[model samples]
Target: MQTSTMRKARYLLLAFSSVILTTGLGGCSVSSILKKGQAEQKISVVPQVLEVNGENVLFEVKAQIPKELIQKKPVYSIDLVYNYGPKMVEPIGKMRFSTGEFIYENDKPTITRQYSFKYTPEKSRGKLLATPHVAKVNKAGKRGKTTEIASGVITTSKLVVKSNTVSLAPDDYRKGVSEPQTLTFFFDEGQAKLRDYLGTNMGVLKELIESNYKTTLVEITAGHSPEDADSKEFRLPLRRAQALEKYYKHELDVKSYTNSSKSVKFRVMPVVRNWDRFLKQVQLSALSPDQINEILTIVNSNVSFKEKERQLAKLDSYEYLQLYVYPTLRYADVRITYEIPQKKDSEIYLLSKKIVENRIDSDKLTEEELRYSATLTPLLSEKLKIYQAAAENTMKWQAFNNLGVTYIQLAQQALKPEIREKLLKEAIINLTYASHRNPTAQLFYNLGSAHHIQGNYLEALRSYDYAIKLGGRVEMLQQVFADKAALEIEIGQLDDAVTSLAYAAPGYQTLMNKALLYTLKGNYQDSKTFYEEALALKPNDALAHYCLAVIAARTNQENDLALHLRKATQLEKNLTAKAIDDPEFRAYVKTPVFREAVK
Candidate 1:
């Protein structure tokens, strides 16, 4: 009985141990399942460094999740953000994968997406981060680990050239000025003789000659009444013109005005069958519009001049025309063009300088002279001072416009941001004032440039459009289009840029922009060609050389890359740091030669 009891105890102990072991094994299995569910993911970003194209920062992201990472009821997604500054983050975009849509059983779950965000200067030094999450349907997701996918934006596209067009006021400082004087003499119908009463009209001509004003030309236009049959001979008008010429010569000789008339050129224009003068006089008379139109219709008809005259004679208003207009037409219209002396350029320039320096009265130089003086100096500071003085003294729109443009030019040359800003502000103020006075194409164009430099892109574009709307000289319009195209390139309007450039004149800026366009389009050969052409125009152009270096780096021409980079750095030392940070030379950055060349 004791042996049987001991056997039952042994069997109960063995069964209890087996149950505990089975429970431990089941717990291990659950822990293994949980570990498998939380597998690690791989995320990759193309252009590991972000790039700014036009006005936007652009990049791409790809995520790979292991199979079984997402359970039947769970969804997978990634949230992206651009961290530029402390407490500053820009939301990029999100990518989500639902359980049913992605089959983890067949293959690893993979997703690739493109992302972009508007770029700002503050966001240039930034990183792009992506965080993954797993969630149940219709519930908050558990956040996975966040990872940085891209860094530091490339802002090479923002280096577009700013070509501002400035407007300068014209000066009335001509070396020689021409003045015209008119003298009229009337004659009877069919007669070509100088009347005694006509001599009175020569007094003004005599005074003009006596004043020592050089008589450059003496033009006599003689007309005869068409009603007289002798007028149709065409000799009558010539004879009338000769009579005036003879009288003019007699006056020149008798009055001893021969010195001023020595070089005078006499031209006799006769009106015989032509009805233009008669019609013009008739139109100015108290005739009705209907009568004028009737006369115009006959005169403009495809008929003989005599036939038109016959038709005119049939009109009811013919009698009035013969009395009022015909007599006026049958007279010598003598026009004497004379030259008036003007100060030499050197003298005018000296007077302008004296006026600016307060050495002479401001009235010594005209308002135009004050404004034009700014253009004679090569120094921008001098120009600025002159324009300011002109604006203050003249209070003219042209002076203000020139002053504003000068301010803009000075701002462009300023090295300090604060100074540039101050100058640009002054420029805007003066330009705005000028616009209120009288808006011109040049003023609007300079305004656009100021706005462009200030980063007011929309306002700049509007100003540029306004400049285009206000038409100007062909050269000025071409410059405007070229500058507008440069702005378009900075904003990612490549197609629009191409169209804008079509109307641009061929110049250094236009060629450089074309090269930049070709570079963006991946036409490296054409881009290189254009860069070469641009360099030819401006041999020491640092930007053009740097662009060539970029092309060389892209094309894997190591020697050319080093050559251009060296040239660029020699011309502009700032390019050395730029090249070191530029991704265009990323592949060569690790190489010893690149380091040596950059150094």
Candidate 2:
């Protein structure tokens, strides 16, 4: 039974093999059907229809056999290449070709076939080339995530992979896959002062980098320039980019993109695309959130903004940076920061950081400057920085106080002793003017300090009392009290001086100064107490030891005093002359130890 079945199967296999050979031979069988100069050839397809439109059928073409193709059976197949658009196109699979029905001679054999093709409304023809058909994608998804959605197209144009692919096409239409990013910078007009606006943006970019600096291939660059009516400098775009680069390097420490990463191989091509015009058009105001949103909403509502696109067509250089307007102070404080495009929260984050890290107008700037110089500064610098703030037009109150403070400093720096009084008088000119111009407690306090620096004791006293009455804070009140105590000592109010120094010591420069005052008044006990306190604050201070040595010599403790004297002499070689010239040291002058210490 087994032999019978095996013999029967062999016969069946031979029949099947013959059938396969015949079908294969029939498919490749080709002959020229040229008659009466009418040239034609029969073409074969895999019988896979892709679409159907009556007689106009398209195919999931298996192969295309060219006219009298040499080694003709079928050598290889080509994958179909096409594009509905840049993102929309890819390779489908290998396809076959077909020849439209043609007439044959009366005696010739007859055969017929059909095909159906699939298509979307997107043009199969690219801006470059076109292919006839491709393998069925079956499902169109993201590139590499699915079968290549092919079309009948070929292109020579190329794009950096990381960058958004831009179509170089018919109408330069927009797809909007990449949104326009925005960053804000507030400029103190004509001052080059930087403010939080730009600083804040930088922080956001940094945050993004922290997530994956090397992997993200992110870089920040800036440019800056100014365009005033008087200057011919017009390279704004270049300047702006340079400014951004400088800030990133100095402030944020972001490195430029490197060629090692294909995603960021290209440098940020910041250029001078009309800096003069950009600055000229910019309103010198710090942008606010609402205003920025308003401007952004308006700008983004446009045809281009709605579509986040990098149009190859923009190379025509018709585009401009879009900036929004926000509230500006009388004299705007300048700031600049970075922004990651399309992310609103990043903008706010950088803005907050900018507020903490920067300030406009610096004490280092000239008094006549229109803006403050900014810096990578510490806390004390922040408090003292705005002292020289300038007026845009004029806020009577701030300007009034500013002028008052300026005059006072000028008087103090006036070196010639004879003209010191003149300086004070000039200071009063501004102080009195400020008193008339919306006077505040701060104004009164400044007036008091000016009077004191000018050596007008009674006038200084009156000003301090008035400043207290005008509602100053505890620290300010303490300062006034301390100054009053110093005046008491000058006039020989020793008991009163002791009391004042006891309360004011903490706020004053050093307890030693007051201790010396006590020593001059013959109060060794009080002097010693103060000297102890001073030493506590400055344990390693050489001057403190010198002061203590002078005290020991005063109260007849020669043996105890000699040790201190020797120590003071060793600490400061000039201790002897300092003691001899000091009135408080007179009692110690008779001591041989004091004389020896001095030598």
Best by TM-score: 1
- Model 2 lDDT per residue over 1-599, tens place: 99999999999999988886544433232222112101222223432212222112244332223333222233212334444576765443433332332223353322333333333223324221123221222422112111222223211000000100111001111122232223333333333334444122343333333422233223333333222311223343334444554554443334434212344321343322223223222222122234334434433444542232233123222121221111111011112222222223343333323433444322222221211211122332331233223222222334345545544445456688667677567656556445434333345556666665655556655665554333334444445546556655543344655554443426223376576676665677887787778767766655656656656755667765666666667777776655564434556677787777666
Candidate 1 lDDT over 217-273, as tens digits, reads: 889998876775546667988998998887776666666454433567889998777
Please tell me which predicted candidate would have the highest lDDT against the true structure.
1
Cα lDDT, all candidates = 0.73, 0.39
Worst lDDT run of 10 residues, candidate 1, spans 25-34
Which residues of candidate 1, in runs, are more than 4 Å off?
1-39, 46-49, 67-77, 85-88, 94-113, 132-146, 168-396, 399-403, 406-410, 413-426, 429-433
Per-candidate Cα RMSD to the true structure, in Å, reads 18.8, 39.9
What TM-score do all the candidates reach, one by one? 0.55, 0.32
- Candidate 1 clashing pairs, residues 3+ apart or interchain: none
How many clashes (backbone N, Cα, C below 3 Å) per candidate? 0, 48
